[model samples]
Every structure is written in structure tokens, then in C-alpha cells.
Target: MKRWWATVPEIAEDVRDALAAGDDIHAIRMLMDGINALPAAQKAGTLDDALNAPDTTGDPRWDALLAGALRYRLHQIGEHAPSWTFKEPLEKGWWPFAYSPSDAYNDMAHTPAELMRLGIFLDEREFTQA
Candidate 1:
């Protein structure tokens, strides 16, 4: 029989709490695991949830980057960005997880155009961008 499930907002909430506590790594873990657990979720729906998730950690950079990265993914799949995406400003710094300068460069070389514009360099794309 097929499994039953809905959107995974729990993952977003978990990420929000983790980020609020300054535990971004844990937040990314939650994001990756959630996507892995529900890999077949409608891509558009998942991206929509991401765009609206992450309510605010009082950190504009993070808030906006998350929205932009998710929105970038939506654009990649040919979906329209939710109107609220413009509310997120383009952050100026690389996201908090950058391990080194070279890593950031490598990431930037491959980051999609929209995310680059939003300034989400050096992301954990394998999962967080999923």
C-alpha cells in the first residue's frame, strides 16, 4: 500500500527553533533529514513551504537567505516564486556555514544565478537546497 503523508512543516519548525537557539548545524540536519524522509513530496509544495517557513530568528541575513535559496530552487524547477520573496533582501555575507574561503569560492562557482543574486553562497546544497 502507498504511504500517507502531508507537508513536513515539523521540519521547518524544528529548524526555526534550532536557528533561534544559534544551532544552525542542527537546523540544517533537521532540514536534510526531513527532505530525506519525504523525498517524494511535491517539489512546488515543498518549496512553497520553505519560502514561508523559517519565521524569523531576528536575523535578517539568515531569514532572507533561506527564502532566497528556496525560491532559487523553485525557479530552477520552473515554478513561480511566491510574492513574499521580494520581502527578503539580498544578504551581503556568505551564510554562516562556510568552512573556508576556497570552499566559498567553489560554492559560488556552482550556485545558481538567482541564489547568487540573493547572496546565499556556500550552502549545504546536497540537503538544505533540496
Candidate 2:
């Protein structure tokens, strides 16, 4: 929970709202950008590093699973091993990242990394159905 963007409640709420509003892709992007913009104290670069890295061999354990999932999806689509990176701007979320710390203290909190993983979950449910 102490990872870079894990403590941001506003981002979480926004993602929830976006999901409720039928805007899942928008929600995912908002979460990504919000985490990217956080200050150094609360920011964790693990996801961003793995996403932007030239090679994924250096990715941390947590990110490796999701990153592998992403790579697999890309391969299924006939793409290269590493697909183009995507991140939504903060405006896509309902609230700004500036208010996330306070929201984390008093409300549900989640990091961009958490939300992105949610994206993978939805994708799997929607696309991998038997």
C-alpha cells in the first residue's frame, strides 16, 4: 500500500466512477497519469519503469506478472513483444491527484499500479470468456 501511487484515493474514486459511468478505458488512463504526476515522497516508479523500459528483464516481481499478461495480449494481437505504452491524463479521472493524500487518509485509496491491474482483470473477463 505504500508503493508510489497506492495511497491515492481520488484516483481510485475516479476509476470507480469511470467504471460506473461506462468509461473504463478513460478510468484506466486517468489512474496511470495521476500516479505519474505524484510527488517523489509518495511516488513509486516500478510500473512506469517497466512500461518504459527497453527490456522487461529488469522489471520487479509484482509488475512482471501483469507486464507478462500485457505482452501476451499484444502477441495474441500479432504485435511485437512490447506494445506501445499507454497512460491517461489526470483530467480523465473525476478528481485531481492533488487531493489524493487526504482522500487516502479518510477514504478508499489505490495507486495507479493497482488500477492498471484492474484494467487487466476487466480485459481478461471480457475477452477470455469461455
Candidate 3:
């Protein structure tokens, strides 16, 4: 499978393509599946690269969401995230998806540790689901 962030060219293409297509979810799914397909030893490093990849998509909100999602993924695997993942500003917002108040309540109620720390409220299923 192709990597979503294997090189500067690839990251630029993938990130910009998704923005042009108005499909942040597809971009994130590409990221999730890309990481999921990697060997255990490679997953964290690839995720870190994806996290650090420049935001060519011109969507800082999406960039922040990527940070939140990748950090959460790292935590799920018991890996320490790249320290930069936390140091940068959160870019101001909640999870970048729409949900009902009840859904927000539920996510808040069952907070996943790392995302909670990042102040991103999302169901882990956002990444955990196939």
C-alpha cells in the first residue's frame, strides 16, 4: 500500500487533493489506514512523520485534527507521541466533525486519555473502526 506521507511530494499531493475534493475524512482515513497497514515497528514513526508533515492543505483546523487523531493513535499503541504534537498550539476548536449534543456528551463522558489531554473530543471509533 502507498504511504500517505512518505515524501514531500506525496504529502503535498495527498493533502492538497483531499482539500480540493472537500474530503477531510478521506484524508484522515488514508492516514489511519496507512498507519494501520504498517509493521508494528514502523507505525509510530510513520505517524510522527504524518504529524509533523507541513499543512499544505491550507486547513489548519484539519491539521490540528490530524495532530489530535495521530496522538490518540499513538496512545492506543502505548507509544510516546512526538513531543511536538503537544507543544504547538491546538489551533482553536473541538473535533472537526459534526455531531449532536448527545454525541458530544457521550464523547465527553467516556474521554479517551490522550485526546482528552489534547482537548479534542472524539469517539475512539473515529480511528478504531475499520
Candidate 4:
């Protein structure tokens, strides 16, 4: 499979380097900056497209990037419009239930970045899980 990081722009190389160096803060900042630099309309549309797109690549890294981007956009939106809800999976192939951001993040995240990614399909977004 193609490496998702390789498909991203040059700025991603810098983020990847930060990640490899265990500087998650810097990496996240760069990621947020990259997302923020886009025009407001484009940023909203792009993020919506990314989040709603199907995950057919079957690549963990790709999923992580998608999820992380979605989370960051959602966070930006939430800053101005706080009324939002998310559906949380209850069981395998079972109906998902509504969850507040706080509860979902608490239950799903083990790191700040993970929380920033909203833990969407997290099991499929990590190398260790693969």
C-alpha cells in the first residue's frame, strides 16, 4: 500500500519528523497550522469531505491522517459553534449511541493527539493494532 505520509505535501515531512522525534506538540501545531492556513470556505469543505469520505484504502496511516484532520476541523468549528454531537459505537456491528465530546474523548484517547483525532476508528489507525 502507498504510504499516506508520502502522499501529503512537504509540510507533512516536517510533521512526520516531529512525530519521529517524539515532539507531538510541535507536530500537532504544524498540522493545525496547515489546516488553518487554508481559506475558511475551503478549509470547511475540505475537512467535511475528508471526514465523510469512505476509508477504502485499508491503510492505518491514511485513516489516522483523515481522522486527525477531521478532529482538528471539528475543534476549530467548536470554538465558535459549540453545539455538536457525535455517535459512539457501542459494540461490533451494533448500534452506536450519542456521546458528548468530553465523554468520548475521555473514553477513547490515551494521548493529546489521539484526543485531537477524536479516536475515530482508532483500532484501525495505529501500526500496533495492525
| TM per prediction | 0.65, 0.29, 0.64, 0.35
Worst 10 residues of 1 by lDDT: 1-10
lDDT at 44, model 1 = 31
The per-residue C-alpha lDDT of model 2 at residue 107 equals 23
TM-score winner, 1 or 2:
1
Q: Mind giving the per-residue lDDT tens digits that candidate 2 earns over 47-94?
A: 433334322222122133234334444444444443433323222233
lDDT (10s digit) by residue, model 1, range 40-127: 4453344444334445645576556555655565565566766766644453656556588877777877766655676776544654
TM-score of model 3 relative to the true fold?
0.64
Candidate 3 colliding pairs: none
Q: Give the candidate order by descending TM-score.
A: 1, 3, 4, 2
Consecutive 10-residue window with the lowest summed lDDT within model 4? 89-98
Worst lDDT window (10 residues) for model 3?
A: 3-12
lDDT on C-alpha atoms for all candidate structures: 0.57, 0.38, 0.57, 0.40
Model number with the top TM-score: 1
**lDDT value for candidate 3?**
0.57
In candidate 1, position 69 carries an lDDT of 51
TM-score of 2: 0.29
List runs of model 4 lying over 4 Å from the truth.
1-8, 40-63, 66-118, 121-130
The local lDDT score (0 to 100) that residue 31 gets in candidate 1 is 54
